[model samples]
Target: MTLASTLLWGVAHLAAERRRTGLALMVAHVLMLAGVLTVFTAFSVDLLSLAVQPRWLIVLTVALVVIALAWTGVIVWSFLLVRPPRSDTVGRLLTTTLTIALCALVLAPTAYGARLAYVSRDVVNSLFSTTSSTPVVAEDPWSGAERVNFLLVGADAAPGRPGVRTDSMTVASVDTETGATTLFGLPRNLEQVRFPAGPARDRFPGGFTGSVPDTPGLLNEVFQYAEDHPDMVPGVQKGKRGPALLKQTIGDILGLPVNYYAMVDMKGFAELVDAMGGVKVTIEDPIVYGRSREGLLPPGTRKLTGEQALWYGRSRTDSDDYVRMGRQKCLLNAVAKQADPMTVLNSFERLAAATKRAISTDLPQELLPAAVDLAQRVKDTRIRSLSFVPPLINTAYPDWSQIRRKVSEALSHRPSTRSATAGRPRSPERTPEAPVSLDATCR
Candidate 1:
């Protein structure tokens, strides 16, 4: 419905409800919900997002919540603070009417603020997100490489934590000519990588904070030691936090340059999946883990909710992060497969209502449609992924030594985004892109 129509309907419904029952519980709740929807729909970036994280749209929500709560509180406080005056019926009605009007007063500012915040965030993201690598595109880079590599990072928001831990790491390689995408998962717990010595340890027997000088087989201990001792000087700042630092750490690892970076503030992922009608992920093994948000998930292909999907990607219960990396890949595939552009467009009216409140991306508005189309074209396409976990990459016997080695390899290997793709071996048929006019069997 048009924003106007929806608002009119909500106002009419609220009026009728008030007439039937003054401040009745159900009546107030119904009105509140209607008002929320109307307001949210009125300010969404694109109505096509209902199939995604539509419900928690930030701007309108922040506005409406403040107004709604304030209204309720005021009405209750007024009743408690004073006796109903010998006021006429008209007076009471007028008071209630005025309160309702004030509640709705949040609409304009809420929407305006939400849009501003959304655009502002994108600006910040673009400014800070330096191209770690060239973008993977349909055409080959002049370097003559067919594959393009992109990095995925799982960042935590815990205060005092060193920037972001490379908890979940994955790399995707796309062959522009063949339309194939392969993903590699890197285990965060890989052995031998030296932990960045917080400021406290900079003067230690080792070297600088991030230097890997002789810190073999004791990688975990470094972080543990740094974490355990806040008294240490290098350890000041309560833990090195700052997202950009961790991005550097990852760039230090895989040897390939990174181009595009996406950081989902730890919440948007799960909500986004469910908002997209849930994803269909194939479970390699049974997941018995449970959380308040996501319950039990069996070992087969199943639809997942936001919390459930989050738990599935992030949970390290029975398995290590290496295994979880695999699960993360599955979830990514599922969401991409389930992206029903048609459903999204059809429900644009409602979905647009929901988009503003819940999610933001580094991609620009002009880029979104193209990204959507690009994602859609690759939909249902088969993808394969690899993870250089444990023995394949980290051969250190002790976890710490192994961690250091892994860290070194990660840093040494870390380079440009395209270099990583160049590092990978592709079938001879997987040459650079051939023009559409070229014969398919020209090879």
Candidate 2:
């Protein structure tokens, strides 16, 4: 309606006998054309591809909004101040009222769009400003051929604890073109985790053999140990000593290059779930939480709140660590499948706040466009998961070669069953097997 009205008004004024009115109408028409061009430019170009700082993004957003408001004011002024010649009192009154109404219609969407854009920019700036405690280098742009691997570390940090321990660790490797993802869950208790040929390897020639009383020579402790003794990994970057060392350690163990790491605070995991209005999952077994054994989450498909989902992923009162790992994987798959754009947009502020507080990653902001594309591909593809547990490999003394080969096979081969979707029932054969379909487990 606004566009049509603007067009009609432009034509009327362009054909006006008075020079002042015609000139004013031409200026207004040009401003309208400029607005249309601005919108087109926004859609055509990757505005975020520019390597601008967060401060610049803020400045640009504010400038654009100011310009929009100024243009709106100009539009109103041009229509109101520029009077048509030989107009009667009632005619002039009606024209002024119609002009105001038209301007309001045009300004409403313009202001709303500008506000949304500003909010989005602010959110991205907030996320980008959240730097890790350590220095990290950015990776080269992805070529869409090789796999991009992200180390998803779930950190369990309790009050009064000396250091944080990564309770759950998984490598999510996505195929560049296909979006097919393979999740390799590293057992926390996995012993003799070899470090790559470096200072780290020289320090522990026989692999990471250090241990505390509770978790003896476990894979998870490597992070805390490295964090405490940064000198062990000589020349390691500050604020990134732990994650860098762990990334290398896990990379060497899996025989795959770990591109990035996202450490999620387990304590804030519930907040993240709540931010997304909770995630729906098909619970295969009864999940028990709390010390009294009374907080029971019964089996069946159900939507879980933040606290319930956290326990669903982290609890091991009724089961063991390995079982808990599987549950975590299921929860992850469910979140990935269910947290679509609409869901996140609906609770955007909450989700953004939760994410900023809970998560930290070394993934470069420049690669977000590629990451988003890859994520879309992953959503459509079958996500296969492989965990080094039980018959597959002993956590006490894991066969490193066997583990690597399983990771390789899972990534190379397509699952025999149909591509898994969230909330669907799984076949009996697909239940908790090695290279299990995450969709099936999360179903």
Candidate 3:
């Protein structure tokens, strides 16, 4: 009877013939059940808003603790009432054991819920704890922006490397209403990148230049260049100066304001993929990448482990940077579409740990709910991609005006006049040559 009280709340009291107490407890149980149902229904409707709020998370934590304590107290009281007053020692032991088991069952879920809430709060605070010193393009939480542009960077700073390199740079421009997105890929070797009007412009009036035979003066070198010349980005923190310069340079190149940047360290990126249980991609040819270019990843459509996936997207052996860019885009699409809610939930802690170590951004904590909402919208719509490579635009002497015009046309939301894979041999894993839906591009 006392064990039955775990669900009935008053079973032990009723069995002990305490009619008034039993009836009162039963009424309280019914009220609590109804309240829980109502709260859950509301929670489902406003989940995005509520989940990201630290105060709301605290409230949820406290509520679970209180419920666990109160419910267990009632169980113990009911056990005491129903236990025989003159019972033998063996009977007392059995009854006590049963009560302990009942209490354990009640407390387990409550404990897990509280921990999950606490972890979520910690992650949000750690990821988005922006200070007044951090420079921002917008103060509001995305209230009136027609389109928001985010600079996505892949920083390669291997263990023995001297400095970080901006190996993979892409801009994701997302439509506020329709969730349509256009990805602009810039080659790492893009030279003669013009700096915007500022200290950098004054320093490099004739555009960024590098040594002829030694250095290519590639766009990727800009990050470390800013770091080396801290005076170029005065008043900014040492870690942030590189990204600040990149944002300005990329924004100028694309003819759009770069709102915020999210950079992932390539070394730690492998860990993130592993945490998500690897990424699935179609490999048309074998890829070779390692310390001495010894490791090889074979061809096929399969789920790749962290190291294999990294090589698949970035391998340069017997291939060019332009081909690698297409593979990287496909990898992005696969991760976006395959990482469902249940997979995330099951691997929540590992994923959170990997993300904290692998990624950094200037996004504010207050904008998390809005960002999450935007991500859901983006998932439902089509994503278009365009890369500035040879024939489209020269990397050594890029036509800035033509690049800007292409960006404008892509964002105009007009129908694409050219076929996505036009004028190019169709490979099994090739990304569309022109701006088009990723669905048609990715396998």
Candidate 4:
């Protein structure tokens, strides 16, 4: 409405000045306005669906660029047509210079904005291009569900490795309305994880006991296993062969339907962190880096670089997997709390490029807008975390029923005294060995 009123006023003013110049200016303004409106409408109307089609996006971008350039030319021509004739050479030269400067001042930002839009569109196209082979669902799988579950996998793929292993496995279950999120971290070494009754179950009757060379059939191996033995789950979609199997297997174990899966390459994860200007984390213990464990990350609250943060989350030479999981959760919480909308908008180009290179997901493109809204809501909500490790649950032979019960209990939102003590001050030296709830505001 504002843009419409402004366009109307501009046309009126131009028309009142001179008939010929006004007509020319009005035509140019109308074309530019129409082009701008069309682009905006495209963004608001099922943009995610359109974004997956690179060719259409490229065409639209080119058209907008052409219109912008032509609009500039018309504005300059109209200015010359309307300007008063100067008798002296110096006066005429000064008038022309000022007019050009004025035009540049007005058009510079518009051109810059158009360029950013083009870059953003290209980033979206690139993100989808790599994952084009991933299966597309007919409709949102969790359309009617009160809660949505996403399987987050951190793949560790070093050079020359034949296949990658999902070293980090977490299920983020979020309440659709409240945006209350519960992060359930499953131990990578967890064994005896059952699959739903079907061909998957038929193959692994005793819950994934098959061995792959030196590696055992642990929970983390599910993704790579599915990739290697695609024929095992013939009914599953061809594009989502690996993630679908892992989702099913993980879903059966947790007694919840996994709606989607997002796999992050470890290297790309570091780049993303760097792009976000590094995430602030409270390191409770010293973290060792590299296979030699020679490089040490001192403990304290500090902003860590991409390399430091990655090793801090994945390092297990000096610490155990449970501790690493805790650190990873802490890093994630810090990112969630600190990477506000403004921060992301400021660093959008870099972040988008890094994300495109690092992340792969089975999430449908149509649901991205809703997911963004949900993320905004999540920023205001406190995130509760639970890790299945050690005394909590046996990794060698996990009690599937017990784990499911825990997950259900956590999601049930049972009244507890823990919520009251969540924000209370605690001694710096008295950090809990295992924290059920994390303070989102903690530095």
Candidate achieving the largest TM-score? 3
Q: Output the number of the lDDT-best candidate.
A: 3
- The 10-residue segment of model 1 with minimum total lDDT is 434-443
Cα lDDT tens digits for candidate 2, 299-345: 89999999899889878886998888888887887897788868976
Output the better candidate (2/3) by lDDT: 3
Please write out the lDDT profile of model 1 over residues 1-443, one tens digit for every residue: 11221223223323334333334544555686787688568844333332122233454456545755555454443332332356567766765565455445645555554654454444334433333234534243323544445555554434564333445656554443343555555565545443244443343533223334533323223333444455443324643232233333344454444433454434556656655666667766667556432556777767777777877787777777666766676666566556676655444433343444333333333333233344443444555444566555652432444333433333223122333545555444322332111011100
Put down candidate 4 lDDT per residue, 106-149, tens digits, no spaces: 56766665565677677655554334244434344345466789
Q: What is the C-alpha lDDT profile of model 3 across 195-288, one tens digit per residue?
A: 9999988988889874456566789988888887888899988988999999999999999999889998876788878988998888888888
TM-score of each: 0.45, 0.75, 0.87, 0.76
RMSD of each: 14.3, 7.6, 6.8, 8.3
Clashes of 1: 54
Candidate 2 accuracy as lDDT: 0.72
Write down the lDDT that model 1 would get.
0.46
Query: Which ranges of candidate 2 are over 4 A from the true structure?
Result: 1-67, 78-140, 143-145, 159-161, 211-215, 291-294, 414-439
Cα lDDT listed for each candidate: 0.46, 0.72, 0.81, 0.71
Stretches of model 1 off by over 4 angstroms after superposition: 1-147, 157-164, 175-180, 194-248, 291-295, 299-301, 346-382, 395-443
Question: Candidate 4: where is the Cα deviation over 4 Å?
Answer: 1-78, 81-87, 125-141, 159-161, 235-239, 340-347, 414-442
Could you tell me which residue pairs clash in candidate 3?
A: none
By summed lDDT, the worst window of 10 consecutive residues in model 3 runs over 423-432
Q: Order the candidate numbers by TM-score, best to worst.
A: 3, 4, 2, 1
